[model samples]
Target: MTRKRQGQQGWGPEHPEQHYLVQPRTVAGGGDVRHVSEYLRASGWRDRSKRGGPLLVESPDRTLRVAYDPHGQPGGWTIHGKATGSTQEWSAHLGRQTPVEIVAGITDTLPLPRSAHAPNVWGPLADGGWHARFEGNSYSATSPDGTAWLQYRQEANGTALWWTGATDTRGNSWTGAFTPTTPLHVVQAFSAQLASPEPVMRPRGRVPHSSKIRTWSVSVTPSQLGAWQQARINAARAATWARNSRRTDRPSTSAPPYANAGSVRTRR
Candidate 1:
């Protein structure tokens, strides 16, 4: 019996079935599948491929799948399994951002988790302050000049709690994590710093008595103050109108006789 000699039977220029088999095309920026697969698995992705078809890895929950195809068009890899069927492609040489990082970045852009205890006033408060609650976190800010604001947030990670704060005046910010306790004193210190008035700087040397004293003052006539007050009132009215309109569009839920009234009276 004569044994048929084995020969190259796959695609590519040297293969006998080059015309019938799909040509291996270069994925722009995708250098090598081996390298991509190595990096992905090194970054905590689990390889689920049993027979080595395409490079397939999934998140812990299997909600996300990152697949690498050497012959895939546009790019080499596809990020799919999102509810919207939204997909992102990546090539080896093009994107320095990893697939996992990209998914995390997208997740961060989503709206904060809504809470039933969320503040009714979504915008700035009447006393030049603002506060909101979302996903068990509290956010607060005080804007004395509208443009310059002091903001703070208390965030938690499992059993750990921390505080982050920022001031719009000088764009100063701070984050304190891994504290043994709640670190309420740090928040108090930040609040005090925000409340402190800007220091008045003067020349060390005494000026000549002949020089006139320069002073600054903000003057608002009664009419101007009244107009400002009216503008705030109008804004509040508009916000209330929009909120009521949204509620009207939704199905009404059964409530006790004083449920709505009680909610209105409660302070967040």
Candidate 2:
């Protein structure tokens, strides 16, 4: 219908106001390594002689030498933690490919949530590895070919569909329909709007039957799209406001801002 521009407080289906903000990791070593002294003590050996002679003391047999690399060498980035339950044992390889390289003990690591810890659940493959969260129950759609159209999907079904731009050889934008089958579930129908050079989100929905299977429509300009987006956002905000207003609790105030500030109003 319309394209939404930045700066609007209200959000809509296509352009939800929600932003996925990640908490920044503050500490080095993936926030694991704590005290320098603690790390040194736990490491196999320290440069006690300070001559760079061997970090680890030689065993009587002289079979193995344990050394500590606080920072993984060459790259200089610290390797603090290891993955648990990995089928292939992960190791630090220097210039050579070795099974294990002596590393500083991983002091601590954070545990992932049980629900998402499994490999079955897909993680966001977007720009960065961002976890995708749908706001206001939105939908996304895609098609395999420009000539042939397919369905659209809601938030629940969004994960099932892949956003491969292959459908449009020129690699333009895609459009799809979100049809509500049940109160909780919806479906997607899709078509490509423009070529890869200039892309835009197009709208698709079930039209009254009798016409041909395909229909052609003109694309809206950026300015026109902006106005439409704002209109939809305003509508959604108004709806949310109305819904909340019905359940609002209006408290009666008896005193002015400065009068009897701590006292509660009592009705006789």
Candidate 3:
């Protein structure tokens, strides 16, 4: 008897045709084979692959939905929003002007959480909304996902100053007075100083071995910060028309402007 070769298929070798079977599936589309309960269990492949394309998919519930600019990416989940609370209290440091240090965990002591961000020293327009001074850094409460509300931090000298926004119940003054139209799921905020450093600070004698201890002089007045706060309030208001504009857009067309000398606060 002659030995059969590995690649050759003949009567003597295991019949290959017998191994192949013809079966039909109920589902017409060519997708992964999964139970109705497990809709996309075996379903593989992304629909469109482009910068902004749509995605083709079947939900776990077996519902089919068309997504724009298909990326064949995984389905996104929903996130719940959270409120910063109804109270508004803040502390102001008079040294220069900067974001008040939100004493960690003691946020409740102020008005909202000490965790809230301070407003920008730069003035807002007659109206208010998000302000993206630089490329895309915005001073607005509300995340890309629309699940969070962010605020700005005010700084003076080289440190944080009074934390504004979130107002008191009596419409007096408190820590956090601002409330989000939608609850904040993610808390996002930041602080910064004048790029030139001339507006907010003054040059002190250079240190023997370190950078000069720059001082902050308010470019805008407390009344200005207050006005900016009001603008913010109007912007946050749901019925306000100013909310239509972007927040980063400053009222003054002047380029790279800073706040006037106000007050300063130091880090504790």
Top-TM-score candidate index = 1
The root-mean-square deviation over C-alpha atoms between each candidate and the true structure, in angstroms, is 30.8, 25.5, 28.4
Give stretches of model 1 more than 4 Å off.
Answer: 1-29, 72-75, 84-268
TM-scores for every candidate against the unseen true structure: 0.21, 0.19, 0.18
Candidate 1 has its poorest 10 consecutive residues by lDDT at: 18-27
> CA shift at 4, candidate 2, in angstroms?
29
Question: Which candidate comes out best when scored by lDDT?
Answer: 1
Angstrom error of the Cα, residue 51, model 3: value is 54
Clashes of 2: 12
Candidate 2 residue 105 Cα shift, in angstroms, is: 49
Q: How close is candidate 1 to the true structure, as a TM-score?
A: 0.21
TM-score of 3: 0.18
Query: Residue 38's C-alpha lDDT in candidate 3?
Result: 20
True-vs-predicted CA distance for residue 163, candidate 2, Å? 8.5
Q: Candidate 2: where is the Cα deviation over 4 Å?
A: 1-166, 173-184, 188-226, 246-268
Arranged by TM-score, best first: 1, 2, 3
lDDT of 3 by residue, 143-208 (tens): 122211224543344332222232212221112222232122112221111111122212122111
